[model samples]
Target chain A: GDSVTQTEGLVTLTKGLPVMLNCTYQTTYSPFLFWYVQHLNEAPKLLLKSSTDNKRTEHQGFYATLHKSSSSFHLQKSSVQLSDSALYFCALSELGSFNKLTFGAGTRLAVCP
Target chain B: GGIITQTPKFLIGQEGQKLTLKCQQNFNHDTMYWYRQDSGKGLRLIYYSITENDLQKGDLSEGYDASREKKSSFSLTVTSAQKNEMAVFLCASSISQFSNERLFFGHGTKLSVL
Candidate 1:
């Protein structure tokens, strides 16, 4: 069985501050990691993803590096904004299993001005 | 460039009633999925289809039925709605064979069982 764990249940930060959401996964095959963000009243959308360990993948000012050694793919942002307030979900899939996605309990991020 | 549309943005049904949610994707993806999201909880997979006429049961498939009649449409039916059941059902699609491909989600159908 594959699983993903996100330790943070809620993350609050001021505008312009850094952001980091921890994510870790367990799987029997090669791992593919992903980040999905859901805004208020909106469907979740992809933020970033990567399968190659040690390589940092980024999109829309958000970045995540998949570290297989630690079985982690932590999402980070240099600066946070009010628009970034949303629920972030960390997901994972086995190397060849694209239909099966294991997602962590999301972290809700609130950016205060 | 593509969109996933889920019908009946909100549904209210009585206990033991049969309710159906429909999802249509224009992405031309080979795989479509149904996920359930409860308040303050994570998304749980209910069902997925790898292609037209192919169905796969996910971690939480009991009491649910799914159909992939065409590549662009996928439907989920609740065999028996439970009392006090309230959750959002999300429909998503993605290109098959891409290990890390992102999933495109629809607006989601919020369900309430009385």
Candidate 2:
């Protein structure tokens, strides 16, 4: 079985500040890591995904690198915007088990003025 | 560019009631899934279908049944609603279950059990 852990339940940051949402995962097989974002009243959508270890994936100012050695894929943004406030979920899928994705508890990022 | 439609944007049920949620997709995807989303609990998979007439139980499949009679449609039923149960049920579809395709999700149906 695979599992993902997001250390933060909520993160409040001022606009233009750097932010990082911690994410870690555990699995016996090769892992495909992903970040999904859900805004208020909207469904979750893919933000970034990566299967290659050590390669950083970026989307919409968010970036994450899959660190197989550390089992981490922390999401980071250099400068947060008001629109960046949302629920972030870290997910993992085994190399061949794309249909069975394991997701973290989720972290809500709140960007304030 | 396709859409996933989930019926009954909101659902209210009484204890011991059986409730069904419906989903349909126009992506012509080969896989469909149902997930339960609770505040701070993240999304938990309830059931998934790789193709027509196929269903596979997920980690949170207990107390729920699923039907995939058609490639474009999937339905989930809660055998017995619990008191004060509140969560969002999301429907999703991907091009194929075997590949690492991104899932396209519907807006989700909010459920409340009294």
Q: Please report the candidate that would top lDDT against the real structure.
A: 2
lDDT of 2 by residue, B1-114 (tens): 889999989999999999999999999999999999999888999999999999999999999999999999999999999999999999999999953678899999999999
Model 2 CA deviation exceeding 4 Å by range: none
What residue pairs are clashing in model 2?
none
DockQ of each two-chain model = 0.65, 0.70
iRMSD (Å) of candidate 1?
Answer: 1.6
What value does the TM-score of chain B take for model 1? Answer: 0.97
Taking the tens digit of each residue's C-alpha lDDT, what string does model 1 give over B1-114? 999999999999999999999999999999999999986668999999999999999999999999999999999999999999999999999998466678899999999998
* TM-score for all models, in order of appearance: 0.97, 0.98
- Minimal lDDT window, size 10, model 2 chain A: A93-102
At residue B84, what lDDT does model 2 achieve? Answer: 98
Per-residue lDDT of candidate 1, residues A1-113 (tens digit): 88899999999999999999999999989998889999999999999988887998889999999999999999999999999999999998887756578889999999999
